[model samples]
Target: MTSRANRSRNNRCATALLVATTLVLAACKAQAPTPQPEPATPQVTADTSAQPARSTDAPLPSEDASLAPAVTTPALPSAFVDKVWKVSKSGAVEPGTTYVFLADGTLVIDSPNGTPMHGRWSFDKGALVMVEEGISYPTEIIAIDDSQFHIRSHNPGEPVDIELVPAPDQPLPKP
Candidate 1:
């Protein structure tokens, strides 16, 4: 009777050991080596939703860069790069918002999806203003640059400053 009980106990111990070994093996297989990224390339397309592509034509992260500076102001219209900019923490762009600008002093921004906000943009004598449609007052453009801008209203409220940055997979400037 003693021998029979000892044999049953040994069987249970062996089964527990087997289960533990199996669990250890599974854990080892769960971890995998991470893959490395390839070399950087150049020549990316213009996209506002994503960052610029990795390319040789693009500037490196260590390169000296500035979004906007006090000096070296650029002229409007010609300097503005027409693209779909993501409105971060700004007022609604309205439904079906389509921004169209012509070189001949004609500008239109319409909302196609929701209520439309109509406004005409014009720059003169180093001043910028948007008026008409539903806006109560004119919106003044304080300053604009490659990656940042400042806009203020005539009524003396907090000036809204925005930074325009390249989206991921965006087109990089030609080197």
Candidate 2:
């Protein structure tokens, strides 16, 4: 009887230790720094009508690195990238949602449901384009300041505007 009681206590101690170790590992992973992604190559289309047709034997334009045009991606506003934004008003996204725009074009969104969504973002012709789950959302920056941001999404058939303010930073959960 005493041996059985000892085994039961030992099993509980082992289970608690395993759970604690798992929580500690999860916290460390959550705090790990994200790796920066490689820059994307810009797509350039040449006008074939202006130049004479070439035979199959001819070298492709990509064969000569000098011929490639220099294209630079416009940088996102410093105010937008510098802070975590929380949704104060929006018809599309729920209020209290948070957003973090990393300089490496990574967009992190946390909704009220506690699920975090990841997406890619880029700038085109002074407009913001966010790609999530393979769908692109072209957005316009209506206004932005140190403490506030406003944007209008031009999703075909479903246009909406959003207002955001700086959100207080939330610390990672501890074990």
For residue 47, model 1's alpha carbon misses the true position, in angstroms, by 36
Per-candidate total of colliding backbone pairs = 20, 0
Give residue 17's lDDT in candidate 2 (0 to 100): 96
Backbone clash total, candidate 1: 20
Worst 10 residues of 1 by lDDT: 166-175
Look at candidate 2 and give me any clashing residue pairs: none
**Model 1 quality (TM-score):** 0.37
Q: Per-residue CA lDDT of candidate 2, range 1-175, in tens?
A: 9999999999999999999999998887766578889898998995342122247785666997774422112324575773688899998889998877777788788898877888877775456887776788887666676667777777779777889988867532111
TM-score of each: 0.37, 0.52
